[model samples]
Target: MKASWRARLAGPGYVILNGIRVINIITFLDIIAASVVMLVKISLTSGFFFFEAVTHAVTAGVSIFLLISELPWLCSYFDRDWPLLGHNSGFITLGIAMFMLGAGVLGNLNRKDMGQDHLGMTFWQIVLSAGVLALVMSTINFVSSFVFADGEKGVTARQIRIYGAVAGQKGEIPRTGSHRTFRLSMKREDTLPIYSPQAGRKSPTDRNSTRFPLKIEKISSPPPNDAASSRYSRDESGIAPPDLAHHPALKGEYI
Candidate 1:
C-alpha cells in the first residue's frame, strides 16, 4: 500500500504540483487568519447587524469559501454541480473580489477607529495587518492560475512535462547543460582539415576542393618595364615587393 502511494507521488511534475497546492493552501490560510481576526473585532464591538460588523462577517464568509476551495477532500463532497465549492476560475475570481471589497471597507473603518484611540494596541491592528497579507496572497494565487491551470482529472493544479520517448523521437529536448556535447562538436570541426586553394590538389575529405599552403616569397627587384612592379615599388625607398612570383595568394608553387 505504501509502495502504491509512493508510485502515485513519484513523477517529474509531482513536486511542482505539490508546491503549487501548498502555496494555494497557505494563501487560503492567510485569508482565514485575517477573517478570524476581523470576526473577533466584530464580536468585541457589536453584533453583525452593525454596518462595520456586517462587512467583517461578509469577509469572513468569503475567507471560509476561499479556504474550502483549496481543500480538495472537503470540496469533493459538494463539487459535483456546485461551481463555487471547488477550484474553479469563476469561483476564485468572485471570492477574491468579495473578500477584497469587504477587507477594504473594514480596513478603512479600522483606520478611522484608530484615529479616535489613545493607545494603538487593538484587534484592528492585527486585523489590518492580516488583511493586507491575505490580499497579497490572494492576488498571487489569482495571477498564478493563468500559468498553472487545473488538471483534466479535476485536480486543482498540474504542470506540463515532456516524456523521454517524445524528446528522443522529436529531438526537441533543450540541450541546456550539455557542455560536453558542445565541446565534442567543436572538436570535430577543429579536426576537419583547413581549406586550401592549390589547383589540381584536393582537400583531405573532398576531391573537388583544392588545397594550398601560404608563403610570402621575398623578391630582390622587379624589371623596369613591368608596370605592376612600378606600382608595387611606388614607395620612395625602392624596396621590391615582399611577394613576387610564388605568393600564396596567387596559388603559385615555389620556383
Candidate 2:
C-alpha cells in the first residue's frame, strides 16, 4: 500500500519533534537541579523563612532559565552572536543570582520583622519582588554575554554579516547549508597552537634524532582533488593549507 504525503513525512517529523521535546525536558531538569542546589546551600533558621526563600529561589531560577534559553534567539534577531548564552554560563549565572536574591529577600523580610507582623508583605509584593529580581539578573547576563564574548577567537565579521543578512530580521538562525561554512570558519579561528621547546628545536635536519618515524598507511584512496581543493589547500609553511587555516582544528599546530 502507498502512503499519503502526510504519512510519508510523519516519521521524520515525529523524530524531530521528539528530539526537541527531549532537549526541553533536559533543560527543565537542569533548572530544577540548580534550584535544589541553591536551596541546599542556604542556612535558614526559621521554617517560614526557609519556605519563603525556597519559593523565591525556585521562581527566580525558572524565570531566569527561560529568559536565558531564549537569549540566543534574541541576540540573533539583533544580528549578534553571543557564545555565553549558548553554553552553561547562562545556567551558572541563573543559579548564582537565584541564591543571592533568595538570601537578600530573606534578610529584608527579617529586618522588617515580617514574622512578628510588624511589616508583612502581601502575596503580590512577593511576586513583584521575584519578577524584579528575575529581570535584574537576566539583564546582567545579557549585558555580560554581549560585552565579554571572545572577539579575537569567537564569531567573525563574515559570520556576523551572514547571520544578519540571512537570519537577523527573521528572529531565527539557520544551522545548515551556507551557515555551516561560516560556523566552521569561526571554529577554526578559535583554535590555538601549543608550543613545545623541544619540538621547536627539532628540524628537518634532525634525521638522526631518536624520534619515532611516522609510518604512512595506504588504507584508502585519497579524496578527489576537486573536493580537497574546495575544502582545504596546502600552504608553503606546511601547516594548514592557506585556504583551510581559518578552520579551528587546522589553526592549531601540534609539535
Candidate 3:
C-alpha cells in the first residue's frame, strides 16, 4: 500500500492530535477535581447548594471528554471497521476514575453532620442537604468509568475505534438521525409532586371547615316597616321628643 505524505512524513497520526487531547484531558480533569473537592467538603460538613449540584454533574461530563480525547490509536488489536486510539484513552479514564473514587470517599466521611453542632440542627435538614451533595459527587465519580473509560493500555491514540467496539465490531451506530419524532412526542414528566402535606388541609379557625366547635347564636332581626323608635327597648336618644330650636307666641297670643 502506498502511504500518503501526511501518514509517513507526519510521524504517527497520534502526534498530530495529541496536542488537542492533552489540553482537553487536563482541562476537564482539573474541573472534575475542583468540583469533587468542593462537593465533598460541603456534603460531609455543610452540604450542596444550587450551582454546586450542577458542578458535580459537570465533573461527570469531564470523563466523557477524556474518552473522546484518546481516539487516535486503540484500533489495531483485531480487524476493525474503525481504528481505536489505544493506551492513552484507557490511562486517562483510569486516572479520572481514581480521582472520582477518592472524592467520593472524602465526601462520605462527614455524613450525618458529624462535624457540626448538635443543637439548632434538624435531622432531615442535615440529611437533605448533606446527602444530596454526597450523592451527586459520588455519582459523578462512579459514572466516570462508563463515561470516559478506554479498555486497554499502551495503545497509541491513532489506533482509532470509531464504533468503540471496532476491534470487536460490536458497538452500535450513534443516531444523528431523526429527532423530529422525539420532539413531537416529547412528554415532560416531573418527578416532583404538585401537592404538599399541608395542601387543602384546613385548621379549626378557617371558615371553610365545619369542625370548629365555637359557639354561634342566630339573632332575630327587627321588622323593616316598623319604626325603630316604637319597637322594643330604645336608647335615651331614641323615642325622644323633637328638639325645638325656639318657642314663639302664637299670632293671636301676646308675645
Ten-residue region with minimum lDDT total, candidate 1:
158-167
**Candidate 3 per-residue lDDT over residues 103-194, each given as its tens digit:** 54345335443244431244333433433443444344344323333232222222322323232233322223235446545632222223
lDDT order, best first, reads: 1, 2, 3
- RMSD list, candidates in order: 17.2, 26.4, 24.3
- List lDDT for all candidates, in order: 0.48, 0.43, 0.40
Candidate 1 lands at a TM-score of 0.41
What residue pairs are clashing in model 1? none
Query: Clashes per prediction?
Result: 0, 3, 23
- Indicate the TM-score of model 3: 0.23
Candidate 2 ranges with C-alpha deviation above 4 Å: 1-73, 77-82, 87-90, 113-121, 124-255
Best by lDDT: 1
- Residue-level lDDT of model 2, residues 89-185, one tens digit each, is 2233443554455454445444433433433344324433543444455454444333332232342222332232221233333333346778778
Full candidate order by TM-score, most accurate first:
1, 2, 3
Among residues 3 or more apart in sequence or in different chains, the pairs in candidate 2 whose N, CA or C atoms overlap within 3 Å are 187-248, 188-247, 188-248
Candidate 3 overall lDDT versus native: 0.40
